[model samples]
Target: MNSFWAVFKRELKSYFTTPLAYVFLVIFLFFSGYLTFKEGFYEARQADLKPFFVNLPLLFVFMVPSTAMRLWAEERKVGSVELLFTLPITIVQAVLAKFFAAWLFLGIALALTFPLVVTVCYLGNPDIGLIVTGYLGAFLMAGGFLAIGCFFSALSKNQVIAFVLSVVACAVLVFAGMPTTLNYVSTFLPPGMVAAVEGMSFQVHFDSMQRGILQFQDLAYFVLLIAGWVAACAIVLDERKAS
Candidate 1:
């Protein structure tokens, strides 16, 4: 437990000790706000932050992977992974620590968008519950993206390759549930298979929560997605350590 905290703290603090983190944060905040406003936030004149939440999955597809691509790839590239493995922490502990650290960092990025929330509230009497659920859904979706990125990061020593693979994988998941994608696939695929694929997509579940309808299945989807990918990441690192 102590070793886990040590590693977790180290990983979290490392984000701020570099200039890249700040640069990434700046870019994320700017685009988040720009995309929200660009989505007719003012023109629509709605008190809700639908525009803000709507762009999260696409934004996270790029941003979260970039944040995660370095988690393990840099350690491997710099040969520090050997030293990391020598620590008292188990592989699973290390993986969880690193995942949590990155998840919290993403959460911080999400939290920094609070000004948008305030703006929505001031403009009109919006459904506070909807705003809360939207944030929750976005945060969970970010975790899912990060988990996939972590797995890809563990698979390669090159950060660029990891980032690219993560982005492709995340984009596929997001696009799979889009109505256009499903309609196109349904033209040839069996109905059951199409349903299965849509169920597996991040969009299907995220859209549910975006509307403040938090079903058990939607929540379970994200929990399982995060757990499954993080476990895969740990397995990959363990194998690499053994070899």
Candidate 2:
């Protein structure tokens, strides 16, 4: 527990010390506001945040990866991963600590968007339940993206490589919903298997949350996605230790 907290603190501080936090905040705030207005707030004749939530996964593809690209890659680049091993902590502890720090950073960015929620409230009698659930969906979706980023970050010593890999992984997750990808997946599969393949996408799961319906299965999908990536990261890093 102590070791986890120590790694968490160190990782959190590292985020603030770089250009990542500032750049992402600027991009996220600008794009979100731009989309909110462009989508026509009160004039759109709808209280739904369809415009806002639609572009969410797109924003996360870049921003979330940017935050996580350096978590472990930077350490490996500087030959400091050995120093981490020299500590009295296990690889899982380090992975969780860094993972949690990245997750918290994503949460903070999402929280900072509260004014958008307030604006929606003031504009109309929007469903607060929907807004709350949408935010939850966004947060969980971001976690899934970040976990994939963390995996790529641990797999390489080059931060740029990690960034590109994270982007690709996240892109595939989002793009699984595209007609081409879905068709391809369904080609050789049975009805139930096709359904299951399409269901593996983050888009399907997140859309359910954005609509204010919190299904246990959607929530489980997110939890399992994050857990799978984090577990893969730990396993790969463990191999790095042996090597």
Candidate 3:
């Protein structure tokens, strides 16, 4: 537990010490706001933040990977992964610490968009429950994306390769459940297969939470997704250490 906090603090501090955190915050805030208004936030004449929540999955597909690409790839690239493994911390502990640190960084980034919430509140009355659930869903979705990125980052020494692989994987998860994608697949595929693909997607569950419906299965999906990838990341790093 002590080792976990030590590494977690070290990892979290590294973000602010570098330009990556600042640049990510700026770009993320700019693009998130731009995409929101561009989608007719005002023109829709609605007080809700639907435009913002609707665009998050697509934005996270690219942004979260960029944040995660350096997690293990940079360590491997500089041969510091060996040094990292030499620490007293176990592989699982190290993995969880780093994952939670990055997850918190993302939470901070997500929290910085509070002005959007304030704006919505100022505009008119909105469903507080829906807004709260939407943020919760977005945060969970970001964790899913980050976990995949962490696995790919551990799998590659090259950051670009990790980033590209993460982006592709995240995109598949997000796009697989889209209405158009499902419709197209169902044209030839059996209904069970199509349903299975849709169930495996990030969109179907996220959409439910975005609409303020937080089912146990939706929560379970994210918990399982995050745990599965983080476990994979630990396994990869453990093997590398063994070798």
Candidate 4:
């Protein structure tokens, strides 16, 4: 536990020390606000952040990868992986610590958008329960994307390659649950198969939470997906260390 906190604190501090974190935060907030007010029709919509939640998954497909691209790729690129391995911490601790650090950084960025929540409340009586659930879903989805990015990061020494691969992989998950994709598959595939594919989509689960339904299955999907990817990352790292 102490080792985990050590790595977590170091990684989290590194984010603030570097300009990447700041730049990412600024870009995210700018686009989030712009999309909510301009594209989301915030002025005209009911007192809710539906539009913002609707755009989050797509935005995360790009933003979250950029944040995670450096988790392990940078370590390998700079020959620091050896140093990491020599430390007192186990690989699992190291992986979880870094994952939590990046995840928390994203959480802080999301929290900074509280002004939107304040605006909605002032405008009309909004369902606070729904709004809270939306944020919960967003956070969980962010972790899933980050875990995917972290796995890809472990596979490459170049940060750009990690970022690109993460984006492509995450994009597929985001679109898999879309109506258009399922519709295309339904033309040839059986209904069961199409339904199976849709069930695997991150969007499908997230949309449920966006509508204020916090089913255990939806939450479990994200949790299990994240664990799977993180476990994959640990395996990759261990193999890389051996070879």
**How many angstroms is residue 210 displaced in model 3 relative to the true structure, after the best TM-score fit?**
0.4
Model 3 steric clash pairs: none
For candidate 3, the TM-score is: 0.98
Cα lDDT of model 4 overall? Answer: 0.94
Q: What range of 10 consecutive residues in model 1 has the weakest lDDT sum?
A: 234-243
Error in Å for residue 229 of model 2: 0.5
Please give the CA lDDT of all the candidate structures: 0.93, 0.87, 0.94, 0.94
C-alpha displacement of 210 in model 2, angstroms? 0.7
**Per-residue alpha-carbon lDDT of model 4 for 1-243, expressed as tens digits?**
599999999999999999988999999999998888876455566999998899999899999999999999999888888998898989999999999999999999999889999989998999999999999999999999999999999988889999999999999999999999999999999999999999999999999999999999999999999999999999998888534
lDDT of 4 at 51: 84
Error of 3 at 44 (Å): 1.7
TM-score of each: 0.98, 0.93, 0.98, 0.97
Please write out the lDDT profile of model 1 over residues 15-45, one tens digit for every residue: 9999867988999999999999985898898
Q: What is residue 219's positional error in candidate 3, in angstroms?
A: 0.2
**Residue 239 Cα positional deviation in candidate 1, in Å, after optimal superposition:** 1.1
lDDT for model 1, please: 0.93
lDDT tens digits, residues 50-93, model 3?
99999999999999999999999888888877887787878899
What's the CA error at residue 198 for candidate 1, in Å?
Answer: 0.7
Off by over 4 Å in 1: none
